[model samples]
Target: MALKILVTAKRVEDPESKIRVRPDGAGIVTEGVNYKLNPFDEIAVEEALRLKERHGGEVVVVSIGVDKSQTELRAALAMGADRAILVRHDGPLDPAVVSAMLQKIVEAEKPDLVLMGKQSIDDDQNQAGQYLAERLRWPQATFASKEASLESEAEQKKDPGVVLGADGRSLTVVREVDGGVETLVLALPAVVTTDLRLNKPRFASLPGIMKAKKKPLQELAAAALGVDLAPKVVVKRLSEPPARKGGVKVADVEELWKKLHEEAKAL
Candidate 1:
């Protein structure tokens, strides 16, 4: 049987371009900002695609968001996932709620390999992948930076570096650690979230975009998944940072020193 890989993606407001800020010291309103896929998730998708190429398998991209997320899902398909799945919603939910939704997706997919970005840039919670793994009772390797062989060196001396399981369960992954990389030879059906170092994401060409339309996309409601989409926490309001004022230029070194000692307090 071919290997199965599940990758999680997210559509987030692009922080690169400026967005409108609230006048009342509230957080920047994201209601109208242009959005893009989380960069780390893109790298995870790229790694999943590469693994499929190397070992021969199917890559399924999953995303949890409102209807606007379909654009991001389609983008994943255009990049080369065999299919896409969307856990649709209307607005932001707490990360824990999102993780609950993802647990349902994991139950449905039952993939040998589960992958996701380290964290979404928007929230930066970095908890979904780990939470999903815990919910599914699967071993997780987070911050994977490279593809790894799922075999021992002694075992690889005879056959391919990759090992096979009697029940079709085995995996090898390279993850990042405190000082450097840690290569983990683990059993299959594992959750592995990727970091930015995993791989460079690809651009979707026009032809690829056309091809993506043919790929299968399955949609599921959060309610249908038997999970409460209600948030455990709430964002009461948001605020923008205070604007900066121009600085005065000193006339000479002595003046600069005086200004530093008196006003700037550098002394």
Candidate 2:
């Protein structure tokens, strides 16, 4: 039987967009900002596509956001996902709520695996994937990096999908750790959060883009999922970091040394 992989692709601000705190500090000003798929989530989609190509599977991408998130889901489909699901929501959501909603979807979809970004760039909370995994009581692997060493390129290519559990129903994941790298073997029906070096996401060719428009993109309401969408955390204010101070240009090494020793109080 072919594998059923469910991936997540979230809508986020363009990486280059300049964001500012709202006037009332309730949220960030999003007016006139460009929105795109979260970068890490794009990697997640790419990994899912690669796994499907290697293992013969169908990939389904999903997102939780407003109606505009349909565009992100379509982008994932354009990259070769079989279909997409958009959990339409317009208000703020805590990671807990998001996880519960995802759990409800998982119960309905019953996919073999769930792939998502290690963190969302917009908020950088880095909690949704872990929380979702806990809610589903499934194994999880995050910050997917490269294995420590591979004797051959082919071995490296095969590393991510290596099966080590009963009846070839497991996956071995190599991910980055604090000082070195760590490897883990997880059973099937696990959650995997992608990182930067996983794979380069393919651009949507014109043909692919046209085909994506015809692909299945289903929309569902959070209410339909039977999970509370209310935020657990309250945002009293939103603020940007303080402006960086200008640095002085020393005329020579002597001046630089003096400034470092005096102004910076260095040895």
Candidate 3:
């Protein structure tokens, strides 16, 4: 049987572009900003497509936002997702609300596995995946560097390599830890969040883009999902980071050492 994988993507400001706080300090200035798929979320989409390719399954990509998110979802479809889903709303959504809505989608889709970026580049909360797993009472693996699975006792000694699953009942994944890696064996219907090293995301080709235009895309309202959207936390203000002053130059090593030891108090 083929595995069913659901991946999550989000629209975010192009990280390369500088972000500015609104004049009133209410929020970010988005009037003329460039928006793109979150880099981490794109990695999630790529990983889902790869899993579908390797295991012969369907890959579904979903995003939450206003109509603008449709473009990002279409980008994922162009990268080989079978279908796309857009949950429509026109305001900022907190991680909790995002997870709650995702829970509803998970229950509705009933996919065998869910793949999502470890965190959205815009908010960097890193909470949605974990929250969704908890709300659904399913196993989860986050910050995964690569795929893995623990074999059943009968197959434990067979090999120590990239095993997708053992007994077709559970999955083991390798997570990037502080200094090395950690392995986790999670049962089917699990959540896995991707990190930077997961894989390089592919760009949509000309042919793929044309095909994506005809692919199936479903739009659903947040109200239809029956999830509350009230946020627990509110953004008080948005501000830019402090700028650094130019550094002073020293004539030689002695002068540098003196400056470092005395002025900068290094020694």
Candidate 4:
């Protein structure tokens, strides 16, 4: 049976770029920051593509952000998604708002599965996927990862961490937990969030990049979705961590202990 999978592509500041909190405590300075698809979401897309390859279906990638987020959506297309959707919304959005928006999309698309990153690097809230699953009242599996190393040859040849059951009515997922890993079997039309070790995302080839331009990329206005976009959580301010003090060399263990106890008060 063919499956239709919905994956998410989130635009985030490149981790390599320097992030600076604005002087007014408003937000980060985006003047020179480069943006890229969130790493976890990339893994999710890869898993979706793999599932499509195995089960024979379409993979649709979606992004919610400013117009520039189309860049990330196109990137997902270049990586092998059948199509893309860009939900244009420019404003502060918390997990609640994002989940609500995604719920509307999910209803419209009616995909068999919703795959996305466990968390976005920028916010690292790790709540959107869970929130979305709760709002949709669907079974959810998160922090997906395989036991083998992602770089290992065996892992490269193995099936995706998220496996579709033989009946195609359920999904089996291996997910990371607090101390180890856990497995879960979810019924169809469930939500799954990818972890770092799920899969290594493939780069877009030159031909793929050219082809992505011709792929169907539908744009939608967030307001028209009829979902309330009111933010339940708000960021009051942003601030940088305090600078670390220079380390002092200790002449002896006793001196180190004294410094730790008195100067640093670590004791």
lDDT of 1 at 161: 22
Best lDDT goes to which candidate? 4
lDDT of 2 by residue, 1-267 (tens): 467888888999999998888888888888989999999999888778777777778899989999999989989988889999999999886788888998988898999989999988988999999999999899999887654334557444643433434455887887877997788988888998887866566787888899999999899998999877779887778877888899889999999999999999985
- The CA root-mean-square deviation of candidate 3, after full C-alpha superposition on the true structure, stands at 5.2
**What is the C-alpha lDDT profile of model 4 across 45-140, one tens digit per residue?**
999988898899999999999999999999999998999999999987688899999999999999999999999999999999999999999999
Better structure of 2 and 4 per lDDT: 4
Q: Number of clashing residue pairs in every model?
A: 5, 0, 2, 0
| RMSD to the hidden true structure, all candidates | 5.8, 2.6, 5.2, 2.2
Candidate 1, 1-267: lDDT as tens digits = 477989988998786857666776345676668898888888878777766765678999999888888888888999989999998787665778887888777777788888899999887889888988888788888887654333444323322223335455666666779988787766778888888656667788899899999999999887788887778777777665576888898899999999999998988
Clashing pairs in 1: 26-238, 26-239, 27-238, 27-239, 170-188
Name the regions of candidate 4 deviating beyond 4 angstroms.
249-267
Query: If ranked by TM-score, best first, what sequence of candidates would result?
Result: 4, 2, 3, 1
Candidate 3: where are CA atoms >4 Å away?
147-163, 249-255
lDDT of 4 at 208: 92
TM-scores of the models, in the given order?
A: 0.81, 0.91, 0.90, 0.93
lDDT of each: 0.78, 0.84, 0.84, 0.92
Q: Could you tell me the lDDT of residue 161 within candidate 4?
A: 72
In angstroms, how far off is 226's CA in candidate 1?
Answer: 0.8
For lDDT, candidate 1 versus 2, the one ahead is 2
